[model samples]
Target: MKNRVSRWLNNEQHLAYSILIPGCALVLVFAYLPAIQSLRFSFLRYNIKMPGAVKFIGLENYQKILADAVFWQTVGRVIYFMTVGGLLVMLLALGMALVLNQEFPGRALLRTLVILPWAIPPVVNGFLWKWILNGDYGALNGLLYQLGLIQEYQFWMANALAALSFAVMTFVWRYTPFITILFLGVLQSIPGELYEQATVDGAGALRRFWYITLPMLSNVGAIAIILTLIAAFTVFDDIVTLTGSYPTFYDATKTPMIYNYEMTFGMGRFGRGSAMAYLIGLLLFALTFFYIRMSLKKED
Candidate 1:
């Protein structure tokens, strides 16, 4: 038995299975199992209010989600948020990365400072911005007043448009540093000889960046875009901290995640909530799949 066990452990296939088994088990337990459970729950009538009425009503929950005007509105808002906020984050990160990639007096210190925001927890970042943007006693209002930009303290959160803009700004601020780090690493990996050769051929700064740097960073950029896209779609803690789930404010800042939370915990409609969650997951998966396919096609 000892000889047989030793032989099995030495076998490459067995060793590989032993190494992968733990990780596979973790994924199965934490991801696949919960997802399957949620999908199952989505088909039932599982409201906390109606405790004894736990019947399987096939597609009813999905039907409600599809027909709900508020749900559709939330979907539109989330799409808008992802588009505007994701672009801003990527652009700002790229710009910052370019600046930081250069030789400077305090380049190291500046890089550290740039990454500080990304290190902050999402909920904490949200609360910090919430205070800064507070209408009556906000630092922003005081600064604007001092600058003579406004005669009075403005209620930034009271206005729906302003609130949405601020939320997007907060998302961009928190995530930009991470993207910057990603791009910076990619930028550093690029061969310096390419830029030197470009300069020898009379290439200016803008032309060098456009022709050489951008093309080299294309794969990294695509990956960053997909990551930011996923993060934007599943955003929750920041929105919750910045804007509490007030029904009045729902029209402006209600993301799909927020809507799911409101339904599942706030209203105790587990079935409907599960359905919405699945729908969002499906949409996200489809979008990511489409992007990956397009990217692969281009590569081919």
Candidate 2:
């Protein structure tokens, strides 16, 4: 028995399985277990502040979430962010990638500088933008004043649409670098022979880029769009840091994630919060499925 056990342990497959067992177990405990608990709580009246009052309340929380006007408004704001912010990010990233694809002096330095914003944490980026957009004494205000663009320092975040626009801008500034890198990598991989052949065939720069560059980038561009939309859905840190997570739903900058935080922690209604999370997850899953299907159809 001892010899058999030793042989089993010495086998390569057995050793690999043994190595993976710990990690698999950790994921089960830390990730899957919590997810299961959250799902269960979503169907119950599991108020953390009133543990004794916990009880199964099937679909009640979900019903409330579906009917909530504030929730729908938050959804609208999410759509705005995804569309506006994603468009800007895609354009800027593509432009930067095209520029970086060229051979020029200090190209490496420019690439590094382009990627610098992606390195900053989301919350930190939010605070940085907040300072720049501050109403009282922001750098933007000072600059505009100096340029005679405005007679006085403007309250950039005072209006709802303006505040949301700035939030989207901050998100775009931070995320565009990563997408640019993605586009640049794919751009670099396209064979130079294709461009040369097109040039020899009397194709202009515009025509060659249209025929070669755009087609090669279609896949990555779709992926980048999906990623940007997903990121917009989960924009909590920036909103919280820039606009302050007020418990009220009237705050224009309150994204879905912030609403979830308010419901769960702020109100101690874990059940409703979990339900909201699952609803958000459902929307994300649907969005992803639809977008991917569209991309695949376009490819076909």
Candidate 3:
């Protein structure tokens, strides 16, 4: 039996090598390599100034992080960002999907235009919105003033609420296209006869959407939501560009991941920074696990 198995694998050597090579390389470079380095570095006191003073302090980094309140505050900010951004982005995407799914003039053009924000890089998107929300020459303030809506331009990023709202808006703009594209694909997949039958039975547009369209799209919507949630929680570049601890220097808008980068690179605490990165990774993995478990239980 052992010889037979070896013979089979040996006979399919080229095919097995092709499948294993790329996947194994990725695991080695991305998953296992950095992880091993992080584990070793987390236990030691590493800094650029004292490269020779590296010594194992065994959990000191974790203990110090635990004593820091700013870390927890940043965690709170991440939760708020994920929850609020997820809801608004999904809603906006669903609305766009529904509108574009209809037979209307310029629908195709509108669909293409709506997805532009998502196609842009996060850093660019954030700065673009920052410009649009600028106190002096922002398009928003200019338009409002022209409409006689406000007497003066508001300093949007100066106020905490406005800054946070603008950051959330950037998130929505970048992610909504992802939602819209997914929902549109699912909408296109749905059979047209369902809509025709509903209309024949005296169903109006609203009724058809609620009964036929919505029900058909629910599974796709659920999957889109999960994908968006993951993306929302993992967001970094946009927040860093738009806010970057904005409206304040310390913990004003620090996501955990950004905090980790600052700790490692900016503050020169390599060991602690690596630990913080690991903590963020663990939190993300836990959140993903819990969500998947709950979803499975609900289906059961």
Among these predicted structures, which one has the highest TM-score?
2
lDDT of 2 by residue, 215-252 (tens): 99988788888888888888888878887743232388
Q: Per-residue lDDT of 86-142 in model 1, one digit per residue for the tens?
A: 999999999999999999899999999999998999999989988998888999999
Q: Count the backbone clashes (under 3 Å) in each candidate.
A: 0, 0, 0
CA error at residue 293 for candidate 2, angstroms: 6.5
lDDT of each: 0.89, 0.90, 0.82
Model 1: residues with Cα > 4 Å off, grouped in runs: 1-23, 245-247, 290-300
Better of 1 and 2 by lDDT: 2
Ranking by TM-score: 2, 1, 3
lDDT per residue as tens, model 3, 1-300: 998767766777766886899999999999899889988888889985679989899999888887879888878877887889999988888888888888999988998898899899999998887778778899999999999999999877776556666777789989999889988998988899988998899999999989988887777677677777778777888878876635472256677777888888888888998878778878778767866865675476
Clashing pairs in 3: none
Model 2 ranges off by over 4 Å: 1-9, 245-250, 288-300
- Segments in model 3 whose C-alpha atoms lie over 4 Å from true places: 1-12, 15-19, 202-207, 245-250, 290-300
lDDT of model 1, residue 154: 87
TM-score for each candidate, following the candidate numbering: 0.89, 0.92, 0.86
Error of 3 at 236 (Å): 1.5
Q: Give the C-alpha miss distance for residue 165 in model 2, angstroms.
A: 0.6
Q: Please give me the total number of clashing residue pairs in predicted model 1.
A: 0
